[model samples]
Target chain A: MSRQNFEEQLDGLHRQLMSMGTLVEEAIHKAIKSLVERDRELAMEVMKNDQLINQMEHEIESGCFRTIALQQPVGGDLRRLGTMLKIVTDLERMGDHAVAIAKTTTRLMAEPYVKPLIDIPLMADHVKAMVRDSLNAYIAKDDQAAGRIAAQDDVVDKLYAKIFRDLIEVMSKQEHTINQGTHLLLVAQYLERIADHVTNICEWVIYMTSGQKTDLNK
Target chain B: MSRQNFEEQLDGLHRQLMSMGTLVEEAIHKAIKSLVERDRELAMEVMKNDQLINQMEHEIESGCFRTIALQQPVGGDLRRLGTMLKIVTDLERMGDHAVAIAKTTTRLMAEPYVKPLIDIPLMADHVKAMVRDSLNAYIAKDDQAAGRIAAQDDVVDKLYAKIFRDLIEVMSKQEHTINQGTHLLLVAQYLERIADHVTNICEWVIYMTSGQKTDLNK
Candidate 1:
């Protein structure tokens, strides 16, 4: 294959990966919304759509392998393919975390509000932005952009700390809120981890561009 | 490098990877035990050991790349090295999850327990077994052993469900149990995740040996 065709193929794979990212990010948002709104139908929708996300992950893996075997990708191209493979694995996992959160929401629908879920959706918003920016950085090959997204992860981490503290206080005050409060805390943690994964992807983009590993959070 | 030398180096790399896995498994067990026993010192130890785990991950990645480049490994050797690299990444993340749990335990030290933490420790024991058995299977190339460990992950999942339900009851009965209950719940979720990762490593092992990707959970 000519260089142009190879470049185009790589671009196509990246586009597919972005699509997968978009689907997962949407699933996460919708899943959380389903839980907050007590919409069983939306929760079911997220669960059913999980198969599509899984299939996309498989397809992206195949594309990476094909690129490796056919193009014999080396240097930056090699790193890009490999990084995408790793990043997508993280993305698929983030989708699973969202599903888990949605399931918890379904169970808690009958319970009274221990507290308002203000922080969780806020954290989700940050996580989604990180996921979007990480992919955009990869496609743009903009390490600066990736680094900025990674830096924002610390904010998510701090937000987790606050959410955790507040949940503990709520549980301490109302013993009945313990079970539901724990589930809410877990949801925040899942979102925080998704953000961490996004930051890891951004780190990979930096590695791909500069051939040096640096933790953007520091 | 001569073929014999390359083989020896590959074997050494595998041995080192297994040793790293051993260290991580021990850290996870110690972390959970510290929590169950409320041993702050043990929790601190787990925190300190996490740095070594991160270092091992970096070392393994570099070693794999060197082996691939220097030996130009092909066929089975290449696949083995590739799988090791991926498994190490999962192992490293598992270590991080353990640390996350340990941190939660330490934070909950000042708080009161909602219950005896029976299910939390039970869940941790199962996850620790999964890590050990999965690594052993990888080292022995025993697909049956790996499959058994993968199948056992449901035990942890079931335990998590029970624990979550119990904690919810505790919270509802006593408003004050919320903070401690939530932290304990996070610890449980972390263990569940560690088991999931162990199962993932087993899947990779299956792929490595049989050149087939089969979901052992099914």
Candidate 2:
């Protein structure tokens, strides 16, 4: 109703979004941790809890619609709400990837790992950092911070390339490793995709602040 | 703006979104055509033309913001614009998946036949149909159509599983086929992801009409 009330609602939405991001960030960490430690229970926990991320996404989206309908927010306020809609989807997808990674962990539980998973876990850590930084950038409305965080995707990309090549070598030399190797490769690909979603966040932040459309992933 | 004017504006946005959706659908077709036919030039064309999809997404998005700021569209109108904004991103990501599939084609171009490749093309056809039908469902505001189209994703998921298991068999049997097999597997995964995006469009369509959130992919 009042401008002050609308701002408080917007502020509340921001806090909820940050909390959603935290849930996703934790999902990524726990999923990858399950992978590294071969903890199927933790992996199952991540998979089971994915519904919460989906629920939060729906709730936040409803809030966006209600704010727009009631407040008729214009200019900066409108853009902020619209951008949060996109950002939460990205975060929810990151949650899906995390669940995917966790599923992979469960699938590979019985098999001895094809490799030590040094780079995969490392990539997961880097991706989790990107997710955090992207949310921080969004909360701060820091355009420069968004760009800085997006550029970090390159590191994740390189790590993926490394995992790809090494897995290929293993699969080629040891035929028995092909099945497990491919699964590991998909896990790496999932992390790479999560990084790409973080870049989407950065792109949305820049659009929110400057009204400029640029693909940070590129 | 009058309600009539807002309706006209919404019509314009719908046409633009369908046009963008067509570009994405064609990209997916050509990308798979290149892969199935082994036409490197066609694959390259798909990759090169991705920028056009990206450009159109920005144009439609900017227009949304313009309509929102100037018109202060409310209720269904505001939600429509917000939903279109989300739909375009989903379509654009499908375009990216098409581009990724084309890149995979290029990477595997030098390799010879990996089986007869019947199922992969079949999967692509089903996914393309899903993309088209999802757009149709959105245009019609037919919530039932959206739900039905979203259900088709199960077929694509089943196809992906078939491709995955068959490819794993191929790679496990022959060492040299490992690289190309993995690439093919990734292509299938890309198509599967595209189907998932199409499901997202369906979910958004239902939400746009009903003002309710549902995950059709589930």
Per-model B-chain TM-score = 0.95, 0.97
lDDT of 1: 0.80
**Tens-digit lDDT track of model 2 for A122-172:** 999899999999999998999999999999999999999999999999999
State the lDDT of candidate 1 residue by residue for A1-218, as single tens digits: 77898898888898899999999999999988987788888998888787888778778876766666566656677677767777778888888888888787788888767656788888888899889889899888899999889999889999998988887777677665666777787788888888888888898888778877665633
CA lDDT of each prediction against the hidden true structure: 0.80, 0.90
Worst 10 residues of 1 chain B by lDDT: B69-78
Interface RMSD of each: 3.1, 1.5
Off by over 4 Å in 2: none
Q: Which pairs in model 2 have colliding backbones?
A: none
Instruction: Report, in order, each candidate's fnat.
Output: 0.42, 0.74
